[model samples]
Target: MSETTPQNPVFPHPAATLILLRDGPDGLEVLVMERHAGLRFAPGATVFPGGRLEAADHHPLWRAHWPEGEPPADLAHRVAALRECVEECGLLPTCAPLSSAVLADLRRGLAAGEGFAAALARVGVAPALDRMTVLARWITPEMLPRRFDTLFFLVMAPRGQEPVCDGGEAVGVLWATPRRLLAEEESGRRRLVFATRMTLLRLAGCADMAAALACAAVPGQGLPAPILPRLVETAAGPVFRIPAGCGFLPLETSAQTVRLG
Candidate 1:
């Protein structure tokens, strides 16, 4: 009999995510949207506003929007984050007085495969590269059928802009304190992906927006190398092992076990 060999898992696509934050009545709150149930990736999971980077994101027109002193190496991530934020939440950093009709048209055009820069040009809005800060990078575990090497960016929402879901990729949206959401997840009332859960845990320690931003500013501490978790099979089932001292929240054990929900 011939022996069978196992195949390698599919590689994750490079993607960028933006975590919009603001002060809530209780404490610092982060925006989250529920993925459409029919979507292929992370269906029905709650996630921050973000998506994979598109080639159009690197259009030359975006260069004019780059912030002073910002390195060029990861400009695409910043652009993609901002674009996705606007598309997913109907919020843009640009203060260029756009009519609601114009904004809706831009979103529709962007969603229909139009380049983000071109859409912005049509609406006369400049990208707000300065508003976003790189928070962390996470690579989806190899054990999963789908994966994404995603960059997470943190930014305070533009003043007077309310975040609303597009009703397509995302069906609903809400803002809640990290502590409150984490507790709800623990009680099984809510579902959170591992990365989102860990992020909330870190933010939960912050007393306010300033404290959170201060914590995020610490180099290598807040933005560490891409976190690639390993999968370990156990009697209970598959559990992901997050290594300790990896610059993210330290695992309780030398390696922390997590269910891939």
Candidate 2:
């Protein structure tokens, strides 16, 4: 480990990511954004839309927005996922129809320090939190300088809404099948963080959006213990490995090849 690296693991900050899915002519496609190369975390990597959770996401005001029934325990995570989705990419999943103009305004309000709930009220739309389903949870490896306890949520992309990168934190956005993304990584055309690569591997199994959602809905599917990779020295060099029976396919790779932020 570098001398500057902390001897003890830093507390992981709460974070959430949204895997926006859709059925394209080619197959099941996911919306991915390229992080700005200057970012302190996961620079230039291709990843699903997401970010750290904000206090506003946990505000009690959101209870009014739920379509029915009690909000899930992870309501804040879901809200943060949707909030980051809109902040990073110009897409909003809402219970009612939302217009491009309203979305643009909401983005502006967010930029100007408007809370997500207030932004929703400003536009008279409620986030379709129910549409999102848990996919996985990953806590960054303890060896990393920055850490996040990130919950990955899967949701179908809203109809008639397209993603536009914010051009700040995110520089570009595109839709591609999971296999195609992995292929790009293989061909050296793109960079995917280890967690993203693993998540895509799971998504690659599904043939379409319906299949993907069905897999997420399976009983006890995504509620497994949080996956925390460990760094160990190997003959080749340092490597990261996830424990067995973590629900993800076994993953062990050179630490140099993996980027966790």
Candidate 3:
């Protein structure tokens, strides 16, 4: 038997998402990654930076370096967040890189196709998982062929670090206003998963990056994996409905099927 979720093993993989934010010409904007074609999941989609946790990400030395408080057994999820950020965009939050050597080494590793996990191991600088605030948890419903226990995290763009699209995995990366991005998605200029759209809508309601980051800083009340169901619509395409008591706003659109909490 697989050693996934003993409690609910059917949904095996655990992942993470990064809600990168910064000030833009217009106003506060969020960094979105345009997923590459080679990805097994969400290919060609505009998504938050993230991926599935890897076994190498859980190295004892790496986990030990995370910020205070015992790391949840889910440290890999945090690693995935960092890895995805680095892979999709050339941004990383390293301490004032001691010298040019630090950056040189980082570039070399990245050039050699070494993801964040590898670069981190080479530099002995483990990810600061404590910096991540789990904003929400989502579980792919059984109806979907693929499922994930994904934890969403929010982080501010670190000083001296600017986000750039990798050209390989991500075609374009931009700090966009939530509403503008929504309009673009609606116009079919951008592609997004139902979850990403809902998350953006919720983030759109927040006043500032500080407030948005604050939500994850405290890891909202608590998260129960949202299991969204798919339902066909008459005028709209397909959409999912949230349970009566779920705090999430209900969405009834034909474009995407989603159930959020």
Candidate 4:
């Protein structure tokens, strides 16, 4: 951790993304939440399941459950990610809510308030981390006062499951397609952050839910250098573009595969 890494008064907290996917009655769709807009940072923006790392996220009990290979350097990041997903979308991919007896035991340990880590252990429920795959990472520009180093994860929800919003932070929760969302962005119907736009473009290339989830799981092990900004002139006005080639490909569906051109 560098001096620049977010600390106590961290201006830019580490964040995570939960891309919820399911084969809905209409077709394949992704879960999205609309922000309340009263607070700072991404206010009123439509986003995926995600939020900042909370202190409870780093409990030692949960640490024991890490999947094989190397554990993430920041466990808080992971806990925040999973917690945010549940809090925001209620699309938890676990074995439903635990039975009453199991829930009691876990809640007691969790009452110790060990945070997401130790509590996860005490509860005896190891989150199926294997089901989650890192899809992309994004850092808000330094120019912004509120910044974040965010990791996006993709998880497939089983059939018949629906995403429910907590109704606090988010005003609307719905399943939408990338292409449809993009069109919404073009019209006055919706708004998207840069990262959301990028992710949607990548998904647009995927034929269906299964294919999209499969593509999301393809892993790469390099930490990308932070992207720099550039100026681009569009007919509407001026649009900025950032360089691609992170762990995941930056894709745009043009007449070709994407509009990365």
The top-ranked prediction according to TM-score is 2
Off by over 4 Å in 3: 1-12, 37-40, 95-104, 110-118, 124-126, 217-224, 230-238, 244-247, 251-261
Q: If the candidates were sorted by their lDDT against the true structure, best first, what order would they fall in? A: 2, 1, 3, 4
Query: What's the distance in Å from true for residue 198, model 3?
Result: 0.5
lDDT of 3 by residue, 61-174 (tens): 665666666667556766778777776676665543323456446656867878666677687664556666676676665455567778787777766666767787788787
- Model 1: per-residue Cα lDDT over 114-165, one tens digit each: 8888788887777677666777788877767778888888877666667779
Better of 3 and 4 by lDDT: 3
Report lDDT (Cα) of residue 124, candidate 4.
Answer: 60
The sequence of per-residue lDDT tens digits that candidate 4 reaches over residues 101-169 is 554454444335545555555566666555666666677744456677777877776344455666778
> Could you tell me the lDDT of residue 31 within candidate 4?
81
Give stretches of model 1 more than 4 Å off.
1-7, 95-102, 217-224, 233-239, 250-261
lDDT of each: 0.75, 0.86, 0.67, 0.63
| lDDT for residue 68 in candidate 3, whole number 0-100 | 61
Displacement of residue 201 (Cα, Å) in model 4 is 1.6
Candidate ranking under TM-score, highest first, comes to 2, 1, 3, 4
Q: Which stretches of candidate 2 lie over 4 Å from their true place?
A: 1-6, 217-224, 233-238
TM-score of 2: 0.91
RMSD of each: 4.6, 3.1, 5.7, 6.9
- The CA lDDT at 81 in model 1 is 86
How well is each residue in 101-194 modelled by candidate 2, as lDDT tens digits? 9999999999899888888888887789888988778998877778999999899899989899999999999999999999999999999998
Task: Give candidate 4 regions above 4 Å deviation.
Answer: 1-11, 25-27, 67-75, 95-114, 117-124, 158-161, 217-238, 247-261
